[model samples]
Target: MGIVELKNLTKSYKQNRGIMDVSFSIEEAEIFGFIGPNGAGKSTTIRTLLNFIYPTSGSATIFGKDIIQHSKEIRQNVGYLPSEVHYYDDMKVVDLLKYSARFHGNLNSTRMKDLAARLDLDINRKIEDLSFGNRKKVGIVQALLHEPKLIILDEPTSGLDPLIQNHFFELLAEERDKGATIFFSSHILSEVQKMCDRVAIIKEGKLVAVETIEHLTKNKVKNITITFEQPEQFTFTVDGILKREVNGKEVTLLYSGEIKALLQHLIDLPVQDVLIEEPTLEEIFMHYYE
Candidate 1:
């Protein structure tokens, strides 16, 4: 069985704005991305898997066990960072971290200290006085300190700066190297493409596509940029040409079809330069989203 599996898993809220009949599976040691725009039910699907909210229909399993039936037992081996961070204002960062460590039954001062220094967080400071970025660092430390088997992050980079974000991604890479399965949910398409092996595209509370990063980016799509010898007003009468644009002596096309046929068409034209490449994740996602 996959490490995490959802069979038509779904949830509905009173406002008619929740996930609908979503289904996907995550393999062990895989970094699976759940991506969409804001208010697209990315967080709702995550909440259901974590059992923070019950599902309206269908079912899901983590570590081969039902999420709701064995939530307490399952959570002990999982680490999570929510999109929003909140804590007791009066508590010191160290104190709060220690409290979370108590559940794991082991506290390594060296590990905690290293994590704080790496993220540029000050444990001596009170939670109330920390900035949003600093508070996010604390949440990161807490989530990773336990060395859980599964890591679930919902927009974990929201409050971090570029430098700190790089450090944080490095830490996640280390965790993956240590055999952790990651479920990363975000509306940021670039970051999801950077860290995930496969992605499931969700839009407006509905799942649209699930594909490997390699497949999504490299296969089934080609962006062609052509510069003709002189200005020409010609039409693209080929199959699978999704979009076409023209300038004085240049033409660009977003295409998906047999390359041989495309090359055959280009051979007879007065082409001076031509470049064809695979499109980026964002470029490809637009086809599905809009």
Candidate 2:
């Protein structure tokens, strides 16, 4: 069985909203990405997987055990960072971290200190006094200190500076190298592209496409730009063309069909310059939505 599995998972609330027929699986030691825009049921799916909320229908499993029935056991090997982080106002950062670590049994003072130093977190300061970025650092430390087998992050890079974000990605890479499975959920496509092995895109509470970054960006579509000679208009149509745009003498399009077919169509056009390149993750994702 996969490390994580969901079978026709669905959740509903008033007004006919919430996730519907959501299903995917994460293999052991894989860095799987769950990506979607806000309000697309990303959190709902994560919450259900964690059993923080029950699914209206369908089911999921983590660590090869049922999510709902074995919540306690599943949690023991899981570390999670929610999109928004909150902490006790009165407790110092160190105290809060210690309190969190206590639940998982022995404390790893050395690892805690290392992570704190790497993140430039002031563990001595009160949680209330910390900046949003600092609080996020706390969340990172809390999630990783346990060294859990599965690490789940929901938009975890919020409030972090670019330099720190780079460091955080490095840490995650180190964890992955050590055989930890990661389920990273984010709306930021570039980060997901940079970090995950495979990605599952969700739109409007439904699974859309799941594929590797390379295949999604390279194999699926090619961005074509054509510039024609003055006074010579160029127009051609072929299958698998999307998001076509024209600006005076230049035309841009996303082409996903046969390259030979596109070449055949382009042969008759009044073409002066033509450029073809791979599309970005955002472009690919938008194509899926379209």
Candidate 3:
């Protein structure tokens, strides 16, 4: 069985829409990226899995146990970092770490200090005195200190600078290397591209697609740009080609299909320059949504 499984999970609140007929599984020791725009049920799915809110229908299981039935056991092996982190203003960083550590049993003080140093966090400062980015650092430390088997992070890099983001990736890689599974949720495609081996894209509270990064980019979309020796006009008949723009001898084609066939047709033309552009994640989603 997979480490985490959502089987036809459905949820709704009052008149607000939530996830519907969502089903996916995450294997052990894999970094899975969950991508979706706001109100696309990304947070809803995460919350459901964590047992924060019971699903209106269907079910979720982690580690071979029902999420709600075994909530306490599931939490022991799970580390969560939400989109926004809040802490008691009077609590110092060290005190916060110590408090969180109690829940997960015990952590090595030396190891925690090392993690703080690597993340450039100061343990002496009170929570209210820390900047947004620094508070994020504290959240990271708390989530990871006990070394949970599965880490569920929702927009974990929001307040971080570029340098810190890089460091956070390193930390994730290290955790994966240690045989930990990470399910990271974010609307930011670039970060998902960088860290996750596989990704699941959600749109309008539906599971649009799920595949590896390579498969998503290589098989899901295509890019074609052609430059002619002289200005010539031409139109493509491809069904999935989303956009076409012509400028002088330069022609750009944003298409999705077998490139070999597309290239064969293009080669016959009096072409001088050719450029192929890969669709961005946003572009890919936009095409599907429209």
Candidate 4:
């Protein structure tokens, strides 16, 4: 069984749309990416999973226990870092971490120190004195300090620098190696491509596609730009070719299918140079959305 499951989950507000019949599962120790555009019900789905708000219909379960009925127990084993983090301005970093640690029992001082050092987070600074990126670092520390079995991060790398972001992913990988399941939600495609084993894409309150990164990329249509030695007017006769353009001696074709036929066709032409570009995650979704 999966560590987390959402079965036909639906949530709606008066005159506003929410997630519609969304369902997906995350396996233990897997890094699952939840991707969508802004206001695409990403946060709403996460809120329901955390039991912050009840779903209007359907169910969500963690470790075979209903989230609504066992919210407290589920929370104890789950760590979350929201897209926007709020905290008391006067509290020092160490004090805040200590307070958060109390909920899950004491944190090992050695582990705490190591995390702080690795993240370049200063424990003595007051929350108000830290920069936005530094404050985000504190939130990251608080989330991982409890050593929860499931970590749900919503745009966790938003305010972080590249160096810190790399270190943060390393920490997440270590936790996953220790058998923790991670559900990461973000609009940043590159981050998801780099860290997630599989991705679930939601658009306009509808779940669109869910597949491993490899499969998603493999199934995406390819754009080929071929420059012929001389100007030649030719039309693409392939079944899967979605688009074709001819500009002087340059021919651009957008197609989806096995490349063998396309390669043979190109070999017969006086092609000067050929360049193939893979579609981006956004481009892949754009095709579906259109």
Candidate 5:
């Protein structure tokens, strides 16, 4: 069985809107990416999985246990970091982290110290006095302190600088290497491409697609740039061409099918130079959005 599973999960708030029939699964030690634009039900699905809100219909499970019925038990092995974090202002960072670890009935003093040092977080500082990025660091450290089996991160890099984000991602990679399953939700397509092994895309409160990163990208879009011997009225009829651009004696376009056919057609044209490469995740994302 999968470590995480959802069967036709639906959550409706009002006016027939909210996530509908959302379903997916995460295998043990897999880093699954959940991606969509704002208001696309990414958060809603995640909340349901965490049992912060019950689904209107269907069901989900984590570690082979029902998410809602065995929430406490599931939570004991799960660590979550929300997009935004709030903490008791009066407490010191170290004290709050200790409390979080104790709440899980597992505290590793060495791990806590290591995380703080790696994140460059000052544990002695009061929660109210830290910067947004620093507070995010605290949240990261707290969530991973107990070394839970599952990690759920919702836009976990929001307040972090690029350097800290790199450090945080490295930490997550280490965790994954140690047999932890990760559920990474983010709208940043590049980050998803960089970190996730597979991705599930949602749009307008419904799932659009879910596939391995390789399968999702392989031969899906090809970016071709060509320079002609002379300026010509560049027009070609082909299937699966999504975009085209023209410049003086140069043409660039995105194609998604039949490389052999495209090459056959190009052989007869005034193509002086050519460059072919895979499209970026953002380009592929636009293809799906369209």
Candidate 6:
């Protein structure tokens, strides 16, 4: 069994909304990405795994223990950062973090201070006084304070700046290096592309695909742009060319299949420059949905 395993998991709500028959496994010490837009049952799946909400059917296990039966114990070694963060307005950040740490017998001030400094967070500030971004920082510190075995993050980079997001990713890498499994859920493709080894795509409460980053991007589709020195029109009659757009002197298209053959076809053209890139996750989504 993997570090986290879900078998035929289903969670149904009114109006026939929620995930259905979703099954996947996350390996130990690996970063697994869950991707979908809001209201796509990403959070529902997560909440069900953590036992915040019960699954309608099927079973999930964490660390070889059933999620429902061993929820309290399972959570002792798991850290979670939800998409939306809420905390007591009356308490200071430091106080709240300490309170949370006590649950895991980890009210270690030094670790908390170190994480706060690394994230440039002021723990002494009152929760109500902190901005949305700063509040998110507090959430980060709280989630990592105990150094849990599994880290589950939902849209963690929402309120963070680029630099801080970089730092956050680095921090996650460090945790992963220390043998922690990471279940990173995000709608943003770039973040998943940068961090996850494998990605699972979900849409409208159903899973569509689960694949390695290279398999999904490198093997599935590539974006190619050919430019000429002067205005020239070109036609590409390739079977796997899913999309083609022509602008004066430039032809851009989304292509799949053998790169060697595509290059062979382009070799005879008057190409001044060529740019080939892997399509983004959004493009991959469209590819799957369509």
Summarize candidate 1's per-residue lDDT along 13-95 as a digit string, tens digits: 99868999898999988899999888999899999999999999999999999999999888998989999999999999999
**Model 2, span 96-135: residue lDDT tens:** 9999999999689999999999999989999999999999
Which lDDT value does model 1 have at 49? 92
Q: After superposing candidate 3, which stretches have Cα over 4 Å from the reference?
A: none
Q: Point out where model 1 deviates above 4 Å.
A: none
The C-alpha TM-scores of every prediction are 0.95, 0.97, 0.94, 0.92, 0.95, 0.90
What residue runs in model 5 are displaced by over 4 Å at the alpha carbon? 15-17
Pairs with backbone N, CA or C atoms under 3 Å apart (clashes), candidate 4: none
Which segments of model 2 are wrong by more than 4 Å?
Answer: 231-234
Lowest lDDT 10-residue stretch of candidate 2: 228-237
Q: After superposition, how far is residue 155 of candidate 2 from its true place, in Å?
A: 0.6
lDDT of 2: 0.91
Tens digits of per-residue lDDT, candidate 5, 121-240, equal: 999999999988998999899889999999999889988999989999899999999999999899999889999999999998899999888877775788889899998778877887
* Model 4 bad stretches (over 4 Å): 231-234, 242-248, 264-270
Candidate 3 C-alpha lDDT tens digits along 1-290: 98999999999877787999899999999999999878889999999999999899999899989999999999999989988899999999999999999998897798789889989999999999999999999999998998999999999999999998999899999999999999999988888988888898888888988889887777768767788999988765656667777888887777876777777778788988777877777677666667
- Per-residue C-alpha lDDT of model 6 across residues 92-187, encoded as one tens digit per residue: 998999899989986889989999998999989999999999999998899899999999998999999999999999999999999999998998
TM-score ranking of the models? 2, 1, 5, 3, 4, 6
The per-model lDDT (C-alpha) reads 0.91, 0.91, 0.88, 0.88, 0.90, 0.91
Predicted candidate 4 versus true structure: per-residue lDDT over 1-290, tens digit per residue? 79999999999988776898999999999999999878898988999899988899999899888999999999999989988989999999999999999998777677777899999999999999999999888889888888889999988999999999999999999999999999989989988988999999998888998899887776658878889999987764866776788999998887786688888877887889989888766666666666
Name the lDDT of candidate 5: 0.90
